[model samples]
Target: MEFQQLASFVEVARLLNFSKAADKLHITQSTMSARIQKLEQELGVPLFIRLGKSIRLSKYGETLLPYALQSIQAMQKGMKKIEEQKSDQTRRLTISAANPFAGIFLPPILAALHTLVPEISIQVLRNTGYSDEMYKMVMDSQIHLAFINNPHEPGVYSEESAVCLIPLYEDDFVLVARPNHPLTGRDRVSTADIKPYPLLFMGQKTSISKHMLRYFEQQQMKQQDKLEINSIPGIKEMLKQTDMVSMFPRLIVRGDLENRDLVEIPMRQPAPPLVTYLACQHDEIEPHLLKIIQESLARTITELGHPCRLFAERLA
Candidate 1:
């Protein structure tokens, strides 16, 4: 049952000499003999056949030898793995975020993170659900860090503790429609300019949707024809089929913009900016790696010009 007992049984079985087994294990002969005896007593079987001057394995010993060797090997492997983890603790890091932000932002940040900490083992958890779910994971220390969009909303993290909310970038919402949509040709578009077209808004619960509703109320315009969509891809596809314009974080639609599949309809006034925050556990994240993550995020945001502008800060 005990690892030490099994190891002694194996050594003695291999050498077939108690003295030689003890020498190999760097233990006294009597101590090694006691270990084998203890194993035999626990298993209710004598492992050795005493034939005066010679010794040979009994039937039970032969059966248990292979099993004992396997157990020992397994334990050795387990110990080795533990040691590796301990030695490389600083090399492992994990981060999580919601689907849209992760897809649009995480890759560049990871690229920069790798450049800065080439030896690190990075684990990115994303699309795990809402920002609140990601926030909880970071708070629980299940993940080392998280990128949360609009974390300021009530009930997102009602109870805050040692976690530091480092603002990564401020992303602005922009009205986007299919490249050749009627509004794209307009020299200037205002809230009224978009009133004639159908509007595709994100779900009401989202910060973007709430902000859009406020914008409409401010302009005193009603969305006569409107649709609520939760999936970003679904909204993009729907826009192509109809003359509907939707508001999205500008960085999110960079690919469509580059392909000219989606064009931004210039506005007289900017939509409310959604600031993406990096939630890091002070106890979980190392100071040096935290700095790397912050710097990498800043670099990536700067490289990708659009709705996102890096918010500078140093981790104390």
Candidate 2:
């Protein structure tokens, strides 16, 4: 009948002593006897054969033992499942990302994560500079995951290391300026052509700046009138008001391009595209969560209609 009644029946049957079964169940002997008596009354059958000092299962009790055991086990399993679900509701995950991903990838990925796993909470650490630092965060277990750029570079850790890098997309740094800017209508604009105008740089430590500088070094050219503005929005606004031009990831500038506020200046020799990676320590994240992140990223890219390919598809 009741859970305690069934439980008392099983325990009393196993021990063959009401006092021992009561002690084991942490109840009084009278309480245990009451539970067993109630169960027997409900079934309309005597469960125990009482022989003065000794007791054993009656025919009815023998038939009910297996079913009682199964009922207790099922109840326990159901309780455990409820506890696990409650635990999931309170579980929290922390992730870090570079500035580019903070703008372009993070918003959609977060929306998707909420839709898929609404029970779990997410904390984001944004604008954590460079691939090497992001890689270190994952390795040190300071964060569950990181969205970084070009972790496969010379100094940064690789897939061969403890960190696993899942490539999400590649964004080429394009020279962008206001629509009415002098360089906008050019068929072929060289770095030499870009030298005269003020160049807006993100930060000396950023991947974008590093890659842009590397491209300049390779071309054996330098811009004299450089203005360093660490903020992307700041750089875009400055471009709108002034003749200054900036090299930015195409993905980040998609909206500005669509609105005709900024136009990509065709480069004769463009800087190499930066590869964005989802980095995590091996077995650090649950497989289901990782799958959700990957699916979210892929879906976001598809919805944005960005010309980027997922690493798995690239390998295929």
Candidate 3:
């Protein structure tokens, strides 16, 4: 029944010589015989055929060999599973990011994380609506870490939320127009030029979107007149047909910018850059999640690709 007894039984069965088995097990011959006898007694079967000084296995002993080997193997397997689960429970890093966080930033970070900590599992809350929702989730202990682009909304800097935002990078928002737009031929456009068409504004919940509203407020343009959508893809799909130009974090549209699917309209106004940050609960147990977030941000900065003169001038 006990592991020690099982080990002794296995050793004795392997050698089939009581004296040698006793020596291998670091016990006296009498002690080894008593343990084997005890095992036979516990199972209520005669395990050995005593032929004077020598011995051999009985039918019961043969059957118990398979059972004992299986029991030991099962115990080892059970212990291994427990260790893996414990590592996951403690080593895990849960990240919640808005949809814009998904495509470019996370992939390289995830690949590097696999190389850094192969045992740790990461859970991503993708297609999420905004930082407010992510903030709520982290406060509830639903997620461990995130890289949130601050919603330029009111109350974002307040202490009511049990979260801390650390600045990682500042990304500018660009007016993204599909190919063949009437204004694509222009060198630059004024804020006045942005309001006439069905503009695909951000869902009002995000800070990036709120910043858009802020830019309009500063420009004194009435964006409330144009079409608005909560989701990014919805805005992109709308732009495929309508004259609706959408805005997004520049890091997110790097591929589009390169391929010309989305052209940056070079707005010359003093617009605020979206401050992308690493956010977490005030009390997080696993500290490794922060490393994962930092490493991911570094990868994001590298992949941003040949920072344009516009980025340098606008960021300045």
Candidate 4:
């Protein structure tokens, strides 16, 4: 079968949606369907089971997924190598990141990348999308890497998967308020300290919100007296002006903390961890380049004085 057909199959399976896969590949939905049907016919098995508006991979599709990814990756690498030979002057690296991480964490990582590969050109896009969407983009080679906060169960995809999700660090979610707020600069503040103030919350779309709700529940606190704000900067600004406090990944508020603009309320030990991962298509990037990027991330995390430990090291 042609590489295009296999590529189409992989994208559809990865996204679990025909229209999105088609949009990603810059093809019409009909064209996408034709490619998948052609591939399935050639294989003599239906790759996907269609149930009304929903679709899922069949057993055969699951078996073919990894191999299809490898084939497309190999072909793409071969093409890229040849193209690099013809135009060796510069190389481009593209990355996507969700909102707050994009602003708070990427600058240092990008700086490190620049230092490591001075001649490379870089493009950073704001993902602000679901982790599944970012996963599809990375799989399709739309972006070379992604910084994502995934709420999926850990260990579902480890080093063995075609995609490598190297976790940079995990930060405990903490409550924060403005500098002069009664809770500011305190080593720790209890849930009782938090109850009297109006609370702000992230949208439920994010894992952070789920953790926050659970934590609030555990503390026997009610979040009904809260404002829902999805934007990180918006939350930060609101905290500065009002007596409201909110939960956040400590890494995102590092600057505010250092500037004395915010403070974390003391919570009991062993808070819920918000893990940030560096995801890449393992087969798409050269091993050595991946190593350099990984090392840069680790070093940057340390330099920034974050408490996150590398996931691979933990496994070892």
Candidate 5:
């Protein structure tokens, strides 16, 4: 059982698709299959069951999943330590974030990090998907930390699963309408009333809205039309011109909230809470990273301020 075989097996299981695993590992599909088959033969159990072209982990594979993930992570850390010694000059700390949180707080965080930790540098990856993908990057040692949305359910390779989650702050989803909208004055707007406007929605592929979309569909309110934009700013822009209402992160529009540029229409049903988090892997905890993580979380409290204070606190 070579480290390469275990690594390939883990990757295949994580994605549940051989082609994606192969693409990620920079290997051909045939090579990826051979490695998984070799690992399976050695273990005397089939790791994956093919359904048409897609793959799912079998019961035996499920039992092995956790250990396979651990083994690969451990080996990667060992290799990273050796590489860290060779570099000697710069300390590498990587952070991945989905679009909403990243765009809002990133500049200040980056500026603060550079000023305080001049000896270290940061690599930031913009991810619009679920927190699970960023968690895998930490497990693979590609990133030491991530500024992410907390997962609703526990994850297999989530850094938050093992290390810690210092939730910086939380925010609620609210409808954004232009300054003069009649609905904003009301104490609560009905889902039925929201149906009348041109609805602008963020894509499900983004961080938190994917989870929120299901709840939205359940209400069964029909909008005149659907405009699927990718960012909070884009949604805000659309609302400015037309009577399009959007469900969005409040943190994205505080300036508009204060000056009455965009009035927040409070909802009948409460919005789902989104906690911005600083997640780190347990075993690879380094001194500078811990310091930076602490500093960043503190800023999320102080700088990002009350837009987050509205929800709840889960400090790690």
Candidate 6:
């Protein structure tokens, strides 16, 4: 029998009155009676003992009552589960970040979210590769949002592209070395000055490396002695112990600079600042949430001694 027939049977069995059961189910008395009659015919047994104005459950109805109640309860639970899934789909956000943003910005962002939007559930995918992979993820809708260094040069992404890029901030790359390192006292450190010391390079694929390479090419300088370490923490630890120097986003080493654990080596000509962007599928994020994220990052930049410049106005 249909679920409606089963539902009618259970309600009638519970209430023991046709009119009350009909009112409870929001069905007409005639409709309720027809449902019961159909259920009885399907089961080949009478479900109610009719005594003029009163009624009681027949033997078959008593046996079927528990099973019908179970079926109705199961259906209700299944429907509730479906609704819960829909709610989660609406409330949840999945975001990816490049390694540097994940390390420097994610914690504060999460803290701001907890205070501002406690009901929102966040799933953060960290260090999921460089800008190209991040761009792909946003374009493919694999993640709701991504924080990455802008992978493209100027005018590379056209208006026809499915992905939208929101400029967040530009992080200046600074040359850093351990306190008291020889280059630290220089008024203006040049590429030739840095050549004697071992240079620690971030992964070549990293945006920082790409920018540094372009800077070196422009300056016609060659780095003879170099070490490549993909992990930022490892590079920092090495800097603390050795005389090696590396270039990093100022915000990444803000604490070290404050504590005098590391000193910035003034460059004769600084490398280009790394511009970060929030990439997403067009119209995938709510405007309010986007504003909150931007404001949070702005707050973080201010807290970090304004190492990065916040972009122009928010995206239209």
C-alpha RMSD for every candidate = 13.8, 15.4, 17.5, 10.1, 10.1, 15.5
lDDT tens readout by residue for model 4, 129-162? 4565676677667888888775463554445556
Q: Write the per-residue lDDT of candidate 1 for residues 178-292, one digit (tens) a residue.
A: 9889888787788888889988987776656666777778778788988988888899999878899988777778789888889988888767777777787664556676677
* Local accuracy of candidate 6 as per-residue lDDT tens digits, 1-316: 8999999998888888999999999999999999999989889999999999889999999999988887887689668758977867646678888867887787888888778888878888767557777777777667878888857544445676678888888888899999989887779988888888888988787777777777777888888888899888899999999999888888788888899989998999887788888888766667777778888888877776665888754656
Which sequence of candidate numbers ranks them by lDDT, best first?
A: 2, 6, 1, 4, 5, 3
What are the per-residue Cα lDDT tens digits for candidate 3 across 150-252? 6444565467665776665677778888788877778878888877766677767676677777777888877646677766667776776667787777766
The most accurate candidate by TM-score is 6
Name the better of 2 and 4 by TM-score: 2
After TM-score superposition, what is the CA distance of residue 224 in candidate 4 from its true location, in Å?
1.2
Off by over 4 Å in 4: 1-91, 118-121, 127-132, 153-162, 179-196, 206-211, 214-222, 302-316
Candidate 5: list runs displaced more than 4 Å: 1-76, 86-89, 126-132, 150-166, 217-224, 286-288, 300-305, 310-316
TM-score of each: 0.60, 0.65, 0.60, 0.60, 0.65, 0.66
State in Å the error of residue 173, model 4: 2.3
What lDDT tens digits, residue by residue, belong to model 5 across residues 1-316? 9888988988898899999999999999999999999999999999899999888999999999899888877777678778976878787777777656677666677777888879877787766456767766765667777777756554444433565655666677777799777676889888888877777777755556654564576677655577888766677778877788776667777777887878888888866766676667665546555566556656665764654652233333
- lDDT values, one for every candidate: 0.79, 0.83, 0.71, 0.78, 0.73, 0.82
Candidate 4 to truth, TM: 0.60
Model 2 bad stretches (over 4 Å)? 1-91, 118-121, 152-154, 158-160, 313-316
Q: Worst lDDT window (10 residues) for model 3?
A: 307-316
